[model samples]
Structures are given as structure tokens and as C-alpha cells.
Target: MAEQIIAALEKIVGANQVLRGDRAKPYLTEWRRAFQPVALAVVRPGNTGEVAALVQSCADFDCAVVAQSGNTGLVGGSAASDARRHVIVNLERMDRVREIDADNATMTVEAGCTLADAQQAAADAGLYFPLTLASRDRCRIGGNLATNAGGLNVVRYGNTRDLVLGLEVVLADGRVWHNLSGLRKDNSGFDLNDLFVGSEGALGVVTAAVFKLYDPVVQQVTALFALDAPEQAVALQRRLIAASGHNLTGCELMSRQAVSLACTHIEGCHEPFEVDHDWYLLVDLASSAQGHWLHEVMAQVVEHARRDGLLSDVVIAHDDERAAALWHLRESLPPAQVAEGASIKHDISLPISKLPMFLARALPAVREALPGVRPCPFGHVGDGNLHFNLSKPAGADDETFLAQSETAHTVVHDIVAEMGGSIAAEHGIGRLKVEALSRYKQPVERDMMRAIKAALDPDNRLNPGVIVD
Candidate 1:
């Protein structure tokens, strides 16, 4: 049966594209080297037709399929375990920017195109695809759509799901669902495109998508402010929202620990303020209007926050170079923490208002559970999502700290649940949080999700062991 399936896939997309045995070892592990899994073969299909054919072949042989793109995912969603029972369909070869409609403000891009490539294509077309994550250079569009990635610009442009106009998905049964319309208004039933956007390749494999683009910003301002506490950051966020309205683009929360790590590890990164505070807020404002004075608006926001005592010190970027440097500090937090040592990372979300309380409860509880653990919490606070990662104490053994991940995760996730938060936010519930979903999700909700998975992929051939059993 395995041979038949392999032969069928080879027939669809040449033998040269099908990697087996020792050749497929590289695709079996995740980017962080945290999870490794064996796969029968890693298949690279060049287009939607080839992907559809591969899916059909897997269905025929009752072989489980795992869709992989870029292999840059933090979660083990793309790794295939046990090759005898699993096959990896890598979309790296499917990269192509099919069309860029400047007038409609949309771009039709293949799933394997890098996020950086998509952004550059949009820029070339004099538009913007604002899903800018740190992994933009390596993460593919399909992976971003699969995860419904929320990045720095999500405060204004929304997530990857929001930016997508339509998708071209190859369903579990090898049937292609081509709903790639760039229409702004469609009262179409079900909106099936959304199902696969954040499905994590469980329901189907995304081959291509039509993404909504935005007018390039003519004026922008980035500012960093030191705040007394999370509450001050929240208050400042509200104040900035009221003052700037739609012009406000991003609001990121950074702990003193996060800032210190970035300064210590990331070269050319410095503290934004002289006096270190408990927390900091990185606020960005962008405007499409050509002559809009974003700098003046930013100045007003800083003045208001100061008068209100929500902010202690502020540093506004005077030019592009300064803005880039300020953003570098925030983006470097993750890598710096990694360099420090093994960290138990939690990408969770809660209500914007409940953030302070959530942190207040979760932080102390986590510390108590894992003594001397450093809490390095930071992320898109404006969108109510926080990374909430915990770094090991200085000189602590990496394996020892990682072994206690469950204890630390439970401490944090319990507080998040109490606040009606999601355990998996921008990052979908890949293999990492499947158990959490089973535990925290309401019985009926889980049943419904299961029903959907069963309905779409009855044989469980598409990305098995993802969101569903």
C-alpha cells in the first residue's frame, strides 16, 4: 500500500521531487529542534494540481498526510512522525506571485511564497501586505494563513485571516476548493475560505490565496515609553486609541526582563529610556493620508500620557533609522531569550482590560511553581495577546527547566482561562497545545469541532493529530 501511494505521488510530481529514506530526515524535525518525527517521504509539489493529486493518492491508500511550508513554525505542526504511517507534503516548490491587482488592492500569491516575498511583491506594486512577523524571511504564506498569524501591524491591519480575501484549498478528498475572489463584499454562504485559514492544515491544504492589500503609509511614527506597570500601559493604550483613532498601528508590551534580555544579547540594541521601569509600551502610528502629521499626533499622545501620569519617560523616533532601531529591540526579544537558555514559551491571549490582573496572578504563581524562573512576557498587548514566555534561572540546566514546562504552563493557562482567554492565540493549536484544547475546551465545542473535522476529512488523511483527534 505504501509503495502504491509513493508511486502515485511520484507519477504526479516527478521522482526527483519525492524524498525518501535518509533524504527525508531534514523535514522530520521542527525549526527549534524541539520536536523530531519520522516520515515515509517528503513530497514537494509545484502547483495546486500536483497537491490535489498527492492528496488523492494519500486518500486512496489511507495514508496520513502532513502539510509542511518553510518548516519555520515554532509549533510542531509541520513535522511528520513515523514515516511508515505518515507522508509530508512540502509546498516550498509552489512559490509564485501569480498576480498583483493594484487597483483592487489585492495580490494572488501561491502558498509557498515567503512572507517577505509577499511583502516585497506588495511593495513593488505600490501597496502593503502588513502581516510582518519576525520570521517573515523564512515563514511561508501558507504557514502564516494556517496559523492566522498576528504580527506587529495587527493592531491596525488585523491578522493574516483578516488580510486574506480568498483561498485555494486542496481538501482532504483531493477536491480543490477555488474561492479565490478578491471581492470586498460577498454574502456567500458559509465563507468556507475561513475554515482553512486557521485550520492548521487539518481540514485541507492551502495551495494559494488572494490577500487584501492596503495603501502604503505616507507618514508614520514609532515611539517607546516607560510605564510604571501593566495598568499604566493599558491606560496609555486607551488614551492613544482615543487620540489617534484609526491612525494608531501597533501597541506592544515589553517587560523590564524582556528589554534587559534584548539589550544584553542583541547587539546594537539599547534601552529606549535611561530609567528602567517595570514595563514599556512600543506604540506605532501610521497614516495613508499624504500630508498627515503623524509626528505631531505622536507628540500629542506622549503629552497626554505624561499629563495623565500613565507614562514616565518617552522616546519618539525621529527618522526611519531610529524607528528601525526601536523595532529591532522589540523583535529581538525572542532570540535574546533563546540565547539566554531554554524557555517555556506560552503564546496566549486575554481581554485587553484583564491583562494586568492576569499577569498579576499568573506571574507570581508561575514563579512559585518554578522557583527562580525569569518571567519574560511580551507581545501584541493592543490585540490582547501576550507571549508570556518564562526563561530559566541563570545557570539552570536546559533539560531540567524544560521538564517543568507543564507545571509553568498550567500555572499560566489556568489564569488565562479564568480571564476567558485562549491558550493558543496567533499560533494555532498545533501538536503542542492539543492536550490543552482537549482539557479546557467545552465538551460541546470540542464535539462540534470534531464533527467539522469528520465531515471535511473523514479518513483523517490531512494533518492528523492537529486540532482534532
Candidate 2:
């Protein structure tokens, strides 16, 4: 049966495109190397029609299909775990920039195109894509859309879902739903494109997207400031918002521990400030208005914050090189933590007003549960999302610390719930968070998700065990 399916896929695409045996080994595991599944073969489709045919073939063969993009996802949403019953459908060959409408401020791009590639295309057209991520050079647009990625520019441009205008998806039955319209406002019923935007391939495989663009920022002012605590950071953010209004583009928080780890472990990194503080914020202001002086505005805001005791120290970027250096510290947190040792990671969000309170309570409880654990909390303070990660104590065994992930997660998640927060903020409920989703998701909401999954992919062939039971 597997052979027959491979033969059919080969006929549709080509023998060279149908990977088997050693060639298919790489597609069997996920990015984190946490989940591995065997598959009969992996198929690389070159076009939407070919993808549709591949899906139809897998359905006819009663085999599960997994859609893969750049394979850079932390969640196990792209690879086949059980090869005997699954076939990997890779979109790497479908990478292409279909069109770019600079006058309309939009771009139509294939799902397999890397995020960096799409951003460059927009930049070359004198526009900005504004979906910047650490893995932008390797992560594909399809995966970004599937996960509804939120990155540095999300404070300004919003997440992948917000930037997307339309999508082309391959349904379970090999039907293509082409709703790739560039309309800014559509009163159409259901808004089907949204259903698949963050579905993690449970409903369909995203093949292409029409994304909204923004005018390039003519002037950007960035600064790094030290705060006494999370409350001070929150206060500064509020003040900046009140002053700059919508011009405030990026606002990220960092702990002293997080900063130290980045500087020590990651190359091309150094401390931005001379005096050490418990917390730091990297703030950016972008303006398109002519004759706008964002630098002066930033300075005024910082002065006010200092007077109010919201800031302990502040340094406005004097040059482009200095500004980039500050950002490097912020972006290096993940890799730095990895180098330190095993980390218990949580990407959570709370109300903007409740952030200080959430941290105040959760921090103590987390320390009590795991004594001497290093709490490295930092993220987008403006958006109320924090990557509150805990690193194992010095001389502690990795296995011993990892074994307490449940206790740490419970302490953090309980505080989040008390503060009316979400457990999973930007990252979707992939296989890693399925159990957590089941625990926290409301009964009605879970039922709705299950019903939608059952209705769309009746056989549960599309990326099984992700976003659904």
C-alpha cells in the first residue's frame, strides 16, 4: 500500500521529487528533536496544484499527511511521527514571490518563501513587511502563518495573522480554497482565511498568502533604559504610550540575569548600560510624519520617567551600531539560555495592568517550588507577553531540574490564570501544549475546536496531535 501511494505521488510530481529511505530520514523528526516519527516517504510539491494532488492521493490511500515548511518550528507541527501511517508533504520547492503591489502596499508570496526573503522583497520595493523574527532567515511564511507568529515588530504591525489579507489553502479533500484577495475590508461571511491562519494545519495546508505592507519608516529612535522592577518598566511603558501615542514601535523587557547570560554566552554581545539594574527595557519609536523628531520625543519621555522614578538609568542610541548592539542582547536570550542548560520555558500573557502583580506573586512561588532556580523573565512588556523562563541552579543535574517542569509550570500558570492571562501567547498549542490546552481551555471552546477539526479533516490526517485532541 505504501509503495502504491509513493508510485502515485511520483506520477503526479516526479521520481526525483519523491524522497524515500535515507532521503526521507530528516523529515521524520521535528526541530527540537523531541518527537520522531517514521513515514513511508516524503513528497516535495512544486505548486499548489501538485500539493492538492498530493493531499488527494494521501486521502485516497488512507494515509495521514503532514505539511512542512522550513522545519524551524519548536512545536511538533511539521514532521511525521509515525511513518508507517503518514506521508510528509514538504513545500520547500513552492517558494516563489508571486507578486508585489507597492502602490497598493501588498505582496502575494508562496508559503515556502522564507520570512527573511519576503521581508527583503518588500524592502527592495521600498516598503516594510514588519514581521521580524530571530529565525526569519530560515522560518517560512507558511509556518509563520500557521503558528500566527509574533515577533519584534508585533508591537507596531501586529502578528502574522494581522498582516495577512488572504490565503490559499489546500483542503483535506484536495480542494483549493483560493481567497487570496487584497481587500482591506471584506464583509464576507465566515472569513474562512482566518480559520486556517493559526490552525496549525489541522484544517488545511497553507500554500500562499497575500500580506499587507507598510510604508518604510523614515526615522527611528531606539533607546535602552534600566528600571528597578517590573512595575517601573510597566510605568515607563505607560508614560511612553501616553506621550508618543501610536509612534511607539517596540518595547521589550529584560532581566539582569537574562542580560548577563546573553553577554557571557552569545558572541557579539555586551552590556548596554554601565550600572547594573534588576530590569531593562529596549524601546523604539518610529515615525513616518515628515519633520518628526522622535529622538527629542524619546529624550523628553525619558526625562519625565527619570523624574517620576520610573527609570533608574537610560541611554538613547547615539549611532546605528550602538542601537544594533542593544538589540543583539535582547534577541540572544533564547540561545543564551540554551547554552546555560535546560530551561523551563513559558510564553505567557497577562493584562497590561496586571503584569507587575503577576510577577510579584509568581516569582516568589516559583522560587519556593524550585529553590535556587534562576528566573530569567523578559519579553514584550507593551503587549503584556513575557517569556518567564527558569534556569536550573548551578551544580544541579539537568534531569533533576527538568523533572520539576510540571511544578514550575503549575505555579506560573496558576498566577497567569488568576490575572486573567493566557498560558500560550504567540506560540500555538502544538503537541507540546496540547495537554496544557486540554487542562485550561474552556469546555465550550474545546468543543468548538474539536468540532471544527472533525468537520474539516474528518480523518485527522492533517498534522495530527496538533491544536486538537
| TM-score of every candidate | 0.98, 0.97
Off by over 4 Å in 1: none
lDDT (Cα, 0-100) at 458 in candidate 2? 92
RMSD to true structure for each model, in Å = 1.2, 1.4
Model 2 stretches with alpha carbons more than 4 Å out: none
Clash counts for all predictions = 2, 3
Model 2 lDDT-worst window of ten: 28-37
Highest-lDDT candidate = 1
For model 2, residues 290-346, the per-residue Cα lDDT tens digits are 655787888889878877888888888877888898888899998999899988889
Q: Find the 10 residues in a row with the least total lDDT in model 1.
A: 25-34
